[model samples]
Target: MSQIVAAIDLRVVQLEKQGVTGMALANQMMGHMADLQMIYNTASDRDLRKLCQRFPGFGRYAMLMEEVSEQNQTMAMSGTHPYGDLPDLPEPLKTALVHVLRAAADLERDFQATADDGRGDNQGRLTTARWRWADDLEKLIYQFQSAELPLQTQALVQQIIKATAERIGRMG
Candidate 1:
């Protein structure tokens, strides 16, 4: 699990360096972080302590993941909107964003279902959905880059992409 997580983390870093940013990047990060959390949860106490000592960032990332999980729980309980104050994006971009968001929601639902089942029967479905979401998001980002949007819109898109990449860097 640790090796798998490390490989995924490295891939994400490489992708970010290549200017890939969006739901796909975020989803990949979240997936590996969850796997890391599972490792900690299932490890013996002494092993967990040793892991923390050997890899200081492990503990910090775990805490960060916990905080994020708690915040997500709170937001879900509060029934708050997942996306707030969406910008006035142009036609296909706006449509693409909507599709990506829906795919994200579906991925989350499948992940939770798999977790609840514990047998991981839904693993294939989750993987397929994740890849599809990633592909769609990649297309959207490419479209945003190629389309002739207003200066403000382009700047806003760039800001979003930069922020996401920075956040992922901090996490890794």
Candidate 2:
């Protein structure tokens, strides 16, 4: 007997190999990322500055997500993106991409929350700085939601995943 394959079947294949779905992977990835965040948040100003300077494009997607002008000279921009188009990625990658995006937003929110609770400088400067970054994160999240990529066709989802991979690869 012969078998039939569909677009969704690849997702199952990926699950069998990875042993974790998109959301779970997203959570795990974010957990690791959170550790980095803690380090960044705790290090001395000089060390933290160095870290930021070294890994400046840690969240380069935040710029594309926020739709910042690629040519803007003021904003510290990474080089041009190669993931300008989407490809036919497996379902697991697509779902994981969305969840990972959510994770990024969550981290941003976590930072914002700390500021809101007066955990930083009592003089409000630290809180203000946190808010400044938080607002940018929020805008990225909002942009994803507005794009409605999840509900769109598989092609669009693939495009996002491809773009994501490209940006991520460029990070290191």
Candidate 3:
């Protein structure tokens, strides 16, 4: 399983270096979805959490790839109506979401930049941003867990939180 994951990770890096993007990159990644899922499902919780800490950006990369693939499928199926409207989020939740999103964007931006190009220490910046993102996500999860949300929303949040907490735990 580790070898399979390593091969996929190497392939992704190679594709990125070759300038693959959008549907092409997502399509390539989609081929490894089953293997990735198997690894996630079969790995022990402690091992998975360690893996996440060791490769901080990998979870986000896999999620983005899967999302891109799903969006492409949706667009192909719906042609013009590719997405639906988002629900009206509660105020506190909305604010939390915004903060989390901004932190995630900052993390991604830092991840893309050179770690040390003589101007600044972007590796430290990236680490800070990653922790901020993780903290914000945990706060958001706590808010959802404590709020008087709709049953479906609460259930979905609980499901996601449970899976994530069990598999990868908290980064901070």
Q: Write the per-residue lDDT of candidate 2 for residues 44-86, one digit (tens) a residue.
A: 7676455445443332222222243333333434534333333
Model 2 ranges with Cα > 4 A deviation: 1-81, 84-86, 120-172
Global local distance difference test of model 2? 0.39
> Tens digits of per-residue lDDT for model 1 on 99-133?
66545544543454455557777778677767777
lDDT of 3: 0.57
lDDT of each: 0.58, 0.39, 0.57
- At residue 34, candidate 3 shows an lDDT of 54
Better of 1 and 3 by lDDT: 1
Span of 10 residues, lowest total lDDT, candidate 3: 163-172
Candidate 3 TM-score over all chains jointly: 0.40
Evaluated at residue 64, the lDDT of candidate 3 is: 68
Error of 2 at 87 (Å): 1.5
